[model samples]
Target: MPQDDPRDASLAVKFSPPQTWTAESVDGLATSGMFLAGIIMVTRNRILAWPSLILGVNSWINQHPLRTKEGGTPPVGNLALAFFALIASYLPLFLKATAEPAGATETQTPLSFST
Candidate 1:
């Protein structure tokens, strides 16, 4: 009996083609991306959040199965939810932009410990 080559097995595993994309896989990726965007929003960083927000919106628009095959009508609930999330994601940035600047204050004198 011929012995199996370890190197061959390792190469087979390493060079295997990636799995094909499916609706479920794409949905999971989109969900994860949206979750990351939400985290960035929490940090109040608009610059980073902007790209993430765009990604999230694109994912929703492209991946959502709102349209029906028979009647061709789109489901309103999911569409509404996507819009709501998109709006909510930008709310922090909007609020920050519209916030009033802090008033100027006089600096306090430093205390000396010399006795």
Candidate 2:
């Protein structure tokens, strides 16, 4: 065989055409996470916010930019929303002082007026 041309423009490795990415279960979870994050952000539910946060992180990790359109902010937005939801849910705990100390008893006395 003749020596290979050094200036050949052909790629050594063949790359298949990019196939459009279809949303599957992971995406569904991301969608549900976004929905739950919205609800959590609105309701400030601490219990449900944790799951939304977890799901948002998951979505961010699984995001595929080259395979889909509008790949810019979906994952980042989801994660941010979830983080905000978590913060919103837990922020009140830090805003006000506790009404009572743990295991403390409250004593009340009636006010008296003497004429």
Runs in model 2 deviating more than 4 A are 1-14, 21-26, 70-72, 97-115
Q: What are the Cα lDDT values of the candidates? A: 0.51, 0.81
Angstrom error at residue 93, model 2: 0.7
- Candidate 2 per-residue lDDT, tens place, 36-105, comes to 9999978888999999999999989988766555544558889998999999999998897858888766
Poorest stretch of ten by lDDT in candidate 2: 17-26
Q: Residue 80 deviation, candidate 1, in Å? A: 7.8
For model 1, the superposed segments whose C-alpha errors exceed 4 Å read 1-23, 64-115
The candidate that achieves the highest lDDT relative to the unseen native structure: 2
Quote model 2's TM-score: 0.65
lDDT of 1 by residue, 1-115 (tens): 2367665654365454334421223345456555655665466454555555555566656753432234433334334444455566668656746454588446758787987
Best by TM-score: 2
